[model samples]
Target chain A: MTENNYIYAPSEHPADKFRCKVPMKGTRQLFVIDGGVQGTAAPLSIKFDEGNCSDEILQVIGVRTSSGPKELSSESSFSFGQNSQGRLILCSHTFAEDPFITKEKIKISLAPNSSVDIVLMQNEHNDAEHISEFEIDIQRDASLRMVFLTLHGGKISNNIKVNLNGENASCDLNGLYIVDGKQQVRNLVSMNHKDPHCYSSQLFKGILDDASVASFSGLIHVWPDAQKTQAYQENHNLLLTKEAKVYSEPQLEIYADDVKCSHGATNGRLDENELFYLRSRGIPKKEAQLLQQQAFAYAVLDKISSEELKERMVSLTEQRLRGEFSKCKNCCKNCC
Target chain B: MLNIKDLHASIGEKEILKGINLQVKPGEIHAIMGPNGSGKSTLSSVLAGRDTYTVTSGEIEFEGKNILELSPEERSIAGIFLGFQYPIEIPGVTNVNFMRTAVNEHRKAKGLEPLNAAAFLKIMREKMEVVEMNPSFSSRGVNVGFSGGEKKRNEIFQMAMLEPKLAILDETDSGLDVDALRIVATGVNKLKRPDNATIVITHYQRLLDYIVPDIVHILYNGQIIKTAGKELALEVEKRGYDWLING
Candidate 1:
């Protein structure tokens, strides 16, 4: 099967290539399937047809090691049967000194009475460009929880579409992006409720600094027959500099008379009164600012159900805010 | 051990606290009573080095060091504290973490080792009891969703934790119920020491009845027009500020 072609031995690759140091407990690490394939496209598929699947987490790491400016494409599909429960983590990293471009298309499906949690972490060097598109579907009595964390990248775009095709389905989507140094990030999300008694929520937050730019556009659609549908969406952004910019738009469309929907978007700066209060308590200006930024990010990080993973992500986020990961520590050439 | 001489301050074009002189010594409590818009809050803000008010011409010396050039945090590290009229609410920052960070900063300035988690928690628990605060408040956000009395008690709790040499309470009696006022005053009195001083600024004499200041000053029209003993507070309470302002 094509799945076997994408599975490799973890021992063949070194662990230092990945920027995050958090160890995923009880997780099966999937190595880079197309390690040496330069400027080529790879297609992979994984299926879970068995019922009552185990709680083991599947972790996939996509790494690009070639030192030339090349383009790569990847397409993946994941499906789960009825009554199955699972978790998936997708991470992308680039160790090359030159600029690398990547395009990814992923699709996920959940059958009746199934549940799943997915986490996508994008942490690449400054010379990397990434674009990811996700299409997800849920059947009757199914549920999904997803989080996207963008720590560092030059130009990143994420487009997500979710459809509730059966009754009693629910989904929670969340994202956090911290960008600086001429970086750009864009996120577009569309949630569709087609049946009765379905629910959805979306919350995304971003912090931009040093001439960076970010944009968020989210849409929630409820069909005519989708009675008792409950949906909510919100986007908040904090700009740290005059040059930093953000554009946010939240839209909602409801054809059903018995549905509830709400959307809100805001752009603001750090509270000056709060900063003065903290400073009056003897905390330095820089340290107080870092604390505020960390507090701003905790809302999204608190959604992770795994305690160990949450702690690790918290530390990683703190390091990123402190500008520790902005420099290329592993690359032989000091490009950054 | 605090001194202010010829202090003149302003916000934008309007001037406040014009040419004021005051002296406070160790082991003493001084009360500054003034009407609204008489610069009571502005004086407190200036003492704590808030950037909103510009010190046009003044000199503030604490323990023989000029403090007007210092930042808020620098002044705080130098043992100066100002209890705000309205405590700010900071979401997502637990009281325990905030106190720990502030206490550690103060300790670091003194070349002392930081307290361990257990030691810090023990100290926090002991100080929290001074305000009769419940243990749950330690893990909640700083002043988030707290009642007016609870916010005042939290200010006192912070004062007890920092142990500053010079404490300035700006209108600590406003919006406080009788019970909360007693608790907060008691907490402040408990933290008093022979080597420190306090400046309690209030509009009414109800708080003075509990704290019992040693000296009282009447501030009017951006100046301290009269200075007297504790009996002056009773006089002002009996008669309105009109008698003192006119004479």
Candidate 2:
């Protein structure tokens, strides 16, 4: 519940328009920060460089509204204590309403043998617009696992960059998005392997319907010194309607021949055999589709460790897939 | 229980089953034996309503109703089952869950009450013994990590659970060992009743030795050329399909 623990540091991203003259402070491990404004909100930046503890954990949860045209910006950098752990759980929800925008950046520094996990969710109003930029750093013997989910939004775009600066550094980035209508989502990612023996894997998937559009551009770069590095990247998109569109590109550049790296991208319709199999098993066509889709999303969702959060996301995901969430604001009107 | 007349089927303009006719009354076990590429699997697929094949011209009747217009699930609800030659391996859905869902759907279609958890588990246990399936396999994903024999047994286990009025085993013996074949054949034999019918499609008579089909038909080039008693199977075993296709 603490909302004033972070400060506005010198950031390379476009600075927020409103810079507070007085500094605000609170506890480090637990805090709340809100950003993104459309109808009415003062531009602000977030920074957290204090709270030097060995086991600092940050859990992020999000909520949203669209009363008027407003914009929100958030920026923060984290450096974990040695042999400690950190977690970021991002959840943002918005009902159907007017438009809002967001500019966000996050950085994490893991000490040797330390690990971090980040779970992010962005579900916005259909009329809302959002854009985000992120930068992350992982140090020696440190690992990072990130799960980013975008369920609903209008004209959403994300730019992300990660730097593995130490040996034995590992990173896993997984994402899932379900979009429909005129909505559009785009993601661009850059992963850097700076030292030897680093490992990175990125898996992203999306389901688009009703003329919606999605794009993914991700690259994994292995430097010369990053020999013995192993990197894998993949992007898969399912177009539920003929009018829906998707563009995916997964790239890998290895300067060191000793490293193993691979990339793949596929955009197509659902598997006909799988659908028929379920249908023949006595499930109606629509129910069979939902089952298959949930299974498809499971490839990425299973990576999450929190049961409560996973359950919530799964419920929301089913509603979105059923075309029941975006239309209802207060309660599920489709059931009625 | 099932009747097919002038059944002509094709895949992408290539005809497979051309002007074939067959009939199977309740309580009878009919075996259709044929060599490779003789439309054996296609017949099963067509019966199962697989979209890969087009029934250019045919009439399929099941239980006094026209089944050609029925969707796959509708046909399943009407009590028609096809034990696939190569069973599909679904990685996430479990065997128990799959069977429960199927059984409930059939019940729902027939205006019967859905079985409660306890009742369903009891029936599952009883049916598992028919196929000699280990109880531990109920939780594993459908056909995932199962050996060839285990998969065949699972198919039969599913059949036992559903208790379809008409069951067609499509080459269910292709990749099975002697013991596995015996178990599967025994399961099928024990499930037979005067109210239900079975169609065993195989390339070899080895299976017929166990199930002992009441009627054996030699299918060649998309049509049933000969129909006889169980002795027909023994004759085909001595002389391969070449005699049937050539004569």
Candidate 3:
């Protein structure tokens, strides 16, 4: 039972490079290694029993190492009891400069009448390869809000599958990814409506620059018995250069007749009229472009329920848009 | 304060303004009335440095300097403002943020310090009142979800904030109701100074009733066919442009 106001991993551990600005008060921070909790017996580790439930936020930081011959992998699971409320923050970062590969699997389950908010941030160096899968099960009268923020990475693939198994369950999922310089990021999301009177909605946006590429494939499936179900999904992308590319596919498969389902996808450049309008008001061209990009990214960032985290994410997103994260290796500034 | 001589401009291959000439002095308001497709908006766009229109020949001189090479932002920072007919809606950038950036840029161009947030808010609140805009509008996105009249009033509010030397209002009264028109007109008139000028481009003579112009120019087919005093607008309103074009 290690409880500290602020927990910092050992300076030698790779998790020390996790750059997220940690929030204050009632946070349990832990560092997991090599896909298992038994690798390092640190002060931050906490043993969780079946009945262990608290209202505090659980912050988990995972770091994968490619120094060994075996491929790195991580597996973690979390379940909440009925009528409980909690928050979870998962941040994964790889500091390896060489070719590295890692796979992570996360499972979350919410009991009846329970609610949870989850934020997953994936930031890795340009030479690293990572794949993450999230399986979420939401039950009767429970709700879930999840945000996936992919700030910097190379060859990152995120697979998220959500199942609303009980009546009156709802899920709101959002994602934002900004990639540049030959990086490639992909998001594959599938939402299942298995019960009646369930609702789900998703919004994902990305901004690609240089020769970066991004892909989004989202599906909404409704069962025949899932009457009175409502689902919506949208994915929008902004390509800054001719070389930048995006592939968006939003699909809906519905077996129920009395359900509402919609999906939309758009890939576009910055609006020239909007740009001209900004510049005509004396804002410089560069600033005007940044302003538009920031505005585009803010739509997803605004979904965060916590004002403290929202403000921090907004500032970080601004820095990322301003090209401040381009040369992260040699930069000595602690921007976070 | 502004002079345009033989301003032959075109969009792609289609010539819009053919050998147009106009002179505006300080402390004066000039009204240019014409029918649709007569290149009234084209003249305004050309003056505000919109890149869609190319100046095939001629020069635009502002305060003794040729401004044909200036970018839209440079023109704006150099004290040229164009009140758009349809104000653009920027969904996430608030009016305060947009106007603060613009005002700071203008101040920077003049070698002055940028206004702090407190000082900027004070000025914004004051200017917003000139258009009778609610204080809440300052926190909203620039013209996002605003009505037609609200958009027009926002343009006038922005003009008041920038305090340009040459303010060009292009069809600003088209969508505005009578009350909104009076508010916008009063805002423009209140900002008038001895060193500033305005060019009101409209198709209706009704706007001239509120902000009376010292010179009125009737444009037809990319050329000014007639130039007269304030009485010209009343005559055009009564007899229509056919009588003037024929006589």
Candidate 4:
């Protein structure tokens, strides 16, 4: 697992060396199992079986970290059994200029007739960098919904690959990223349909301001044997300034007939008619923009099944969009 | 309580409204009817402070202030509302959430406390009946997937929610069916008070039968060519605007 996941070409990625280092200062580390202190060899490996799992278990997963900015390096693996139901939240954050370097790989396998919800909240400090890679597998009668939100980060990248290896498996991937200033974010998604009667969807949106840069590339593959497959992909981007930039690509390869598939991508400024409509209703220009953006982001945030998790994500997103996080003094270090 | 004097406006170097004059008082309903491209909608756009329409030379005073100097949102906060011809569709923004934000903003401008959730919801529910809107719309995105009539009715519903001092309904009857037209006109008429006024802009007299404007003006070639009473609308509808324009 270590060789297949952590081996990045050093010639091409010199920064990967700094990120792959262990027991290093000036870098916030991932919270590991049995204690997150530096040099701890603990990594969370959870396999949920059928049971009455409560929110307390999710709470123990440390959705709320201790006060002050922290960082880490982690390799976590999670799996579920038949009829298992629960939510798992992973947060990548930092409090200051100290880099928050995370090389995370989440490998999830769901048994038949089971489901799970995953929220990957990538919210690092202004000077932090985070890289997360996910390899997921779905079985027959299994479904998965995962939301990836990139709110505040200096340099962030999310690499996700999902394979529907069994019949009747489905996956829903939704993401929202709002970046400003000199920040940069990238998301690359790859999904493969290996069996018949499988489903997959992807929706990603980005709002860029100042000199920020964001990119989204999604690829869906339907093998010849994967008949009756349904796949959809869409990416939308909004640039708030002339200097902001975005690159979006939605690619699909189908070797099977009798399949339903569609893909679309859009990049532009805010809608003039919608802005005028909001302003005509008495909302100030600034407030009107925030409302529209919040509405734009709700498509991804509202997909979380847990009410508490959904509320928490909404507040976090609102704070980021309102520019509250940019205010260093009020930057509650304990904020998740 | 709304007045426009020698109002001349243009869009991108093209003059659409040329030296128009109008006066609307409290409790009065004034219908501005004209042929297509006769500047009926331009009047509403200029009054609403839409940035696209530049006020080349004119005066629009709302409640004693020169509204031409205010931004679109400032004019709205100052009790001026424009019912859109084509309502904007905002996906994922629930109607209740949008209205709550808009209402609170207006309240904030007037130095009044914002209504709590319960109070706001009650008001929304009560006003939804005015336009025959389903209660479920409060949770649906604003104007998303709505039919033509539903879009127009939603505009009137927003007017009912905001309770503006000067309401300008621009071509509100264009896409509406007879039943929807009655409901929308009823909502407009119900919102009228002795302290508020309304300006109905349309291309036909079908809506005037229900709203019953006190005065009718024929706007032709960017000017109000003739001004009269409700009987004038019947004459224009029966004889058509060619007579008015040719005269």
Winning candidate number (lDDT): 1
TM-score of chain A of each: 0.89, 0.81, 0.87, 0.82
Clashing pairs in 1: none
Per-residue lDDT of B15 in model 4: 97
lDDT of residue B135 for candidate 4: 91
**Local accuracy of candidate 4 as per-residue lDDT tens digits, A95-180:** 34654555666778887867777777776677677777888988898899988888888889899999998999999999999999
Task: Give the TM-scores of the predictions, in the order they appear.
Answer: 0.92, 0.88, 0.92, 0.89
Candidate 2 lDDT over B1-247, as tens digits, reads 8999999999998999998899999999999998888898899889988888999998999887888888888888788888988887776667877788788888988899999989999999999999899999998878889999999999999999988889999999999999999999999999999999999999999999898899998888899999999999999899887887888
Summarize candidate 2's per-residue lDDT along A1-336 as a digit string, tens digits: 113533322222234222212111221222222453221333332333333332333444333444433676666555665565666665555433656676666666676767777777787778777777777788889888988888888878878898998999899999998889999999898999999999999999999989999999999999988999999999999889999999898778778889888888888887777677666667777877776677778778878766655666676677888887632224332111
lDDT of 3 by residue, B1-247 (tens): 7989999999999999998899999999999998889999999988988899999999899999999999999999999999998889998888998999999999999999999999999999999899999999999988999999999999999999898999999998998899999999999999999999999999899999999999999998898989999999999888889987787
Among these predicted structures, which one has the highest DockQ?
3
lDDT by residue for model 1 (A233-255), tens:
98999899999999998888888
Residue-level lDDT of model 4, residues B3-117, one tens digit each, is 8999999999899999999999988999999999999988998888889988999798887778888988999988899999999999978899899999999899889999999
Each candidate's fnat, listed in order, reads 0.64, 0.45, 0.73, 0.89
Q: What's the TM for model 1?
A: 0.92
Return whichever of 3 and 4 wins on TM-score: 3
Q: What is the lDDT of candidate 2?
A: 0.78
| Winner by DockQ between candidate 4 and candidate 3 | 3
When summed lDDT is taken over every stretch of 10 residues in candidate 1 chain A, the lowest stretch is A327-336
Worst 10 residues of 2 chain A by lDDT: A18-27
